[model samples]
Target: MLNQTPLWKYIMVLMVVAVCTLYASPNLYGEDYAVQISAAKDSTVDLNLVDRVNAQLEKAGIETKAVALENEQILIRLNDDSSQRLAREALESALGRDYIVAMNLAPDTPEWLDNLGGTPMKLGLDLRGGVHFLMEVDMQSVMTKSLKDMEGDFKTSLREERIRYRRVSIVNDVVQIQFRDQETLEKAEFFLKNRNADITIVEQGELTLVASMSETKLAEIRDYAVKQNITIMRNRVNQLGVAEPLIQRQGADRIVVQLPGIQDTARAKEILNATATLEFRMVDLDHDVRDAVNGRVPPGSELINDQQGVPQLLKQDIMLEGSHIIDANSGVDEYGMPKVSISLDSAGGSKMSLGTKGNIGKPMATVFIEYQATNEKNADGKIIFVPEREVVSVATIRAQLGSRFEITGLDSPKEARDLALLLRAGALIAPITIVEERTVGPSLGQENIDLGMQAIIWGFVLVLAFMLVYYKAFGVVANVALTANLVMIVGVMSMIPGATLTLPGMAGIVLTVGMAVDANVLIFERIREELRDSRSPQQAIHHGYDSAFSTILDANITTFIAALILFAVGTGPIKGFSITLMIGIVTSMFTAIILTRTIVNGVWGGKRLEKLWI
Candidate 1:
């Protein structure tokens, strides 16, 4: 009974290997080129859209393997990249701007596996091929927006405090306020200083007071903008249905985004660069829109076009910005009409409640603002954002609306869903300009994958030959365990969410192969030492495993700690490496100790042997 294993251990090892094998089988099916058609702001994607897509492809003589409508998007699977490109071009030309025609790689997983919630391992940009963008946040716009908000706060605070001021305006990057007297200036300065801790307050002479952000505050603002933009970008990219995307901060004000298995650069760029937000403002019914259109715009109002391109006058003061919106969803009203349900934070709820309390039956306009990059580049070779504003909805307040409200005058369900998506994605703190863009072709990705696999295969072959030649029968057990270890690694990775495999991750896998065999080497050497002590085969096997347990634990635990640190502090490729390293350590430990011992026990346990193959 020295080398005998418990029945439960055998069952656990078999169950793990079987489950891992089942989950890891999906990777064998590979992927297909798919043309994805998503409804734009004004378009609808239903069965009719799928029919139209099929018709358009047929008319263009493009062959498609399948067409399906899912999640309000049409997915058309094609035979090759050439067909995908051709189909996308034809569909784009036919659909115009109503739909976003993008190309992606769709998994060819079988229905049974899919039904079981099985999916292929997520591949990184380098392995699967996609677009990479290096974006720089417009920190100047961030500062300007901050200054404008401060200017509003300053005016409101001064008016509430009964302090007289000629005017408060943001000139350049500084907030300038002209007070009537030195006493008012001193009082206002104290109030503003306490309220605006991020800004430095300066009194110019006796009547003018200027406030600007400190250098440290500016840096903090820029960093926050970059980080916030990264989060928003990640949310927006979810619309692309990417499995695993990389959106992280790079340096001070830049972000790096990599979208794997996406081939539509134009649509990806549009989604990433789009800076959409909603603003609720009072409809300036006191001002005549005709006069504003005639270039006689009012001082405290602005003329803007609605979604139909009709001009309307709106108050310059914003009641609520999109940033306050916490949740949004597309649904139907009591009359079953399409509407967007919106929820706001406490501050936004208070602001809305106060703003609408006095304006019962008054018209409130929901202004949609978007900042787009122009084709023109500046001297610094960065794209400039051209601000475009439009009134998307104008509705009369029926009651005092607070945190929750609905926009029911949408043109279609698609519009409602789009508005909800924009609200949920959250507005970017500032516009982002793509300073660098790169596309990785599928062929190149396949080549890299091939090279990585080649390295793994050669390493595996060399290890197998050495073990078989030296350890004989015991080497066969180690190789089987090694294979099972690899399977479990892939299985665990596929099971986990957001665990993507990259090139560096492939290197980690290769490294794991060597480390896994090293564990076996330690046990085999320990067994050899026991044999030299004149112990029987069963005694040697049991003592070898028992003696090597502590050494294996110490070594693997140290390596695992390093992997954890790498995953904690590292980004991008380094993180990829760390993830695989950590997973490999876990799986290898199980295979090397539990699995190999189980197999060995089943083979040679409770046997009286004079000599051992090992």
Candidate 2:
């Protein structure tokens, strides 16, 4: 009974193996090349749309394995990539912008397993082939905008508070209010300190109060720009029907976006960099547009060109910004004119209500702003981008607009839908320039998968052969555990939501194949040493396993710690490697010690033996 494993222990090990094997089974089913079609905001998606897609695909002479509408999206599964591309192109043209036609790799997981929350491990860009983008957030733009907004708010607040100031301007990213005297400056500084908790009174002179955003506030703004960009990119990716995208903050001012299975780099860029924002400002009826456009611009109004390049004067004060918009939908009005209905959050509603109440009969313009990156670099070696601002629409303020409003000057339904998509997806707080772009085709991804799989297979087979030839019966137990070790590794990887199977991750698995048997080697050698000292086979087996546990635990603990550090500090591929290695170390320890010991117990435990083979 020296080496007997309890019934409960056997049950636990069997249960673990059974579950891991079950979860690992889905990866064998592979994937289906498919096109996913989702409706735009206020657009309808139904069986009729599925029929339309099918007809279009058929018209293009592309055969689809199945065309179905599920979860408010139409999915067309094709036999191969050729048909997939053909079907996507045909459907996109037919469906138009009302539907988001995106290329996807729909998993061929069975209903039962899928319903049980079993999914194959997500593949990374290197393994699945897609686009990788390194985007840099414009932190300067963020701080500048923050300062401008604060200046606007301060000027308005001081006026409302009956505090007079000669000038309020932003100098060196600090808002300076120049008062008539020191008494008024002190009054303003005291009022500001009480009003806003995020501003610091840097220096107060005789007639000027210099205030800037506190370090914490500036940090929060920087974080907001980066994190908000990540969030919006995720929304755009979801809208584009991308599956398992990796969008994360890289550093203080950078982001890493990896879209797996996305072949269209242009589409990827469009989705990530589409920071179209809207600004509502009153058309300056008091200013002369001709004079402003020619040589003498007005004091508080700017000369802007409409979408048709017609000159117009507009107030510089923004009544509302698109950042406050919560939702937008494109629909036809009663007259059948295309329009976009907008919904604003509570703050925006209040601001719009206040800003438009006095301008009832005046016209307000919707200025569309799009940032474009240029090859020209700034003095700081950063790329410079131009914001092409155009007055898209001018509408009369019929009444005081609040949370709900409509803009009806859209030329077509497509334009209205495009505007709605931009609004609904949320605007990036600041513009992001693409510092780097890389595309990995599906063919290359498949090549990586093949090569990585070959590495793992070969390494695993060699380890299996070595154990079998050297330790015989004990080797047989380890080989079985090793197989289960692999199964459990895949299973655990699949179970973890964030785990991605990259090419480097496969290398981690291969490294683990050899390391998985080290504990077995220690135990078998220990048994051989004990047997040479004239111990019985059962005694050798018992002492061998019991004595090796501490060494195995110590060795594996150190490796796991190193892997943890790597995961903590690494990014992208390094993270993939570290995570997989960490998971492997854990699973290997279980398979090598617990699983192999249970097998050895069942096979040869408590039996009388004159000699030991291990």
* Top candidate when judged by lDDT against the true structure: 1
lDDT of 1 by residue, 68-182 (tens): 9987788898999899999989999999998888889999999899888789999998888999999888887788876776676676567666889998888877889998888
Q: How many Å off is the CA of 306 in candidate 2?
A: 17
284 Cα displacement, candidate 1 (Å): 1.7
Q: Model 1 scores what on Cα lDDT?
A: 0.88
Per-residue error at 115 for model 2, in Å?
1.9
- What TM-score quantifies how close candidate 2 is to the native fold? 0.77
User: lDDT, candidate 2, residue 60?
Assistant: 88
Candidate 1 residue runs with Cα over 4 Å from true position: 162-164, 289-296, 330-362, 377-381, 395-416, 607-611
| TM-score, one value per model | 0.92, 0.77
What lDDT does candidate 2 reach at residue 266? 70
